[model samples]
Target: MFRFEDNKCYRMPAHFGGFDCPGPEAALYYKDAVSVTFTYTTDEKQLASYVPEGFELLRPELNISYSQFREIDWMAGGAYNLVQVSVPARFNGKRDQLEGQFILVVWENKTWPILGGREETGIPKIYADIEDLHTIQPNYYTSASYEGNTFLRLELLGAKPVNGQLLSEMQASAATINALGWRYIPKVGAPGADLSQPILYPQGAEVHSAWAGSGTVKWTQLSWEQNPGQWHIIKALAELPMLEMAPVIMAKGVIILKPNNGRVLE
Candidate 1:
């Protein structure tokens, strides 16, 4: 349940710190905050030739199917990456050309799923290999449409929300990830235009953390530097069980086990 890829053909990595796009016109289009924004005119024909690939439609839907959720939890042993954010402001909502950067908030969630039998009613269910009471939190990512009148859609690979319940700021350590969604925050480019959501990760998910081990916090970027006594990895992979629903904005992180032999990477 752990592999993720962006619309443009780049695979997502664990522990995302930030992301950057680098094209020749990079500076011209991406000069504002690290973000994505698009302007839309009601001329149906304008987007007529628009083919929605990579990115999924940011529209009304609910719950991802059971088959679509395995993508977020497939990481190799000792395999980790970063989650980088770029606001379309980098280009001031312009689409001339763009380059993006992914910061280094590099924590890791290594998930592992097993084929558990059916439920009381006999519905197939996947069980996580973690302990009970492990909190499951959701991670959030967002992008805005920009000056090109281009509608930038986030291709949701997981389950869509069943009832518009946005858990962008959901708390808990998580046995699994939950519903993901996109908010409609206009990029007039202000604090109000910031629609990015935060997920409550288990403490010490990062190697160098500040919180004691349980805190709901947000930041501009993230990185991994082993500072054992400082960081905490409380949640286990067994917490997030697999469900059959394509959540739009959220995905399950690696079903991480308790860190015993894992060494800190630079």
Candidate 2:
């Protein structure tokens, strides 16, 4: 027999067939990552509906990133790729106090990470075909596609060691943003349930090494079944002006993610 509660299943001992957990371990630790951040202009009102209460849109710029992770703790130390789309927002209308970016969509190659990220952090993560290729020595390239439509592409031109001043500034910005948590809409199991409550995860990354470089980015519309909840995101992206073809911040480094016990901030 099985019982469903709080979006999780509880099976009776009699029904247990001596099977281990169906998902990965409680946490995943990434070893190394190479990433590029691209900033684009968009209409602020289009994103307003997605922004939760007590948070305000900080800028019209949207940040999209492509990252490749190696030596992940799970999957027997295998590698995977990830793509994220986010927007900057301020909390409590405080201009000086900038909160972390609100992630609109995240795509990964692995299933375990996608499941964990969606359930734990309320991240809108999905599994897709991700390709990470190295054409020339020290030059990395990546792309993500779904239903035969490629939606994202990235290329890292080159990377070099960072100076002390740049490293200090990066560290300071990381510290300041680390205090903020991500706000997202939770998946409801029952119909007519209270969907107004937002889920918040107190998570941030600690940058171990920072590199400076240049790169390129491109985005296209993804073809997928759109639910009512996803219409806002689709419309928002459509309203954005042409994104800059080049990345503003191209970095290759490693970081330790700090994802605390998640909770609802209602």
| Per-model TM-score on C-alpha atoms | 0.17, 0.71
User: Where is the poorest 10-residue window by lDDT in model 1?
Assistant: 28-37
Candidate 2 lDDT tens digits, 57-154:
78777777777788877667888888888778655543334456767677788887887676555677876678875657356677877655566676
For this target, which candidate reaches the highest TM-score against the unseen true structure? Answer: 2
lDDT of 1 at 50: 25
Candidate 1, residue 209: the lDDT equals 11
What does candidate 2 score in Cα RMSD to the true structure? 5.6
Question: Scored by CA lDDT, what does every candidate get?
Answer: 0.21, 0.61
Per-candidate clash tally: 90, 0
TM-score of 1: 0.17
TM-score of 2: 0.71
Give per-model CA RMSD: 22.4, 5.6
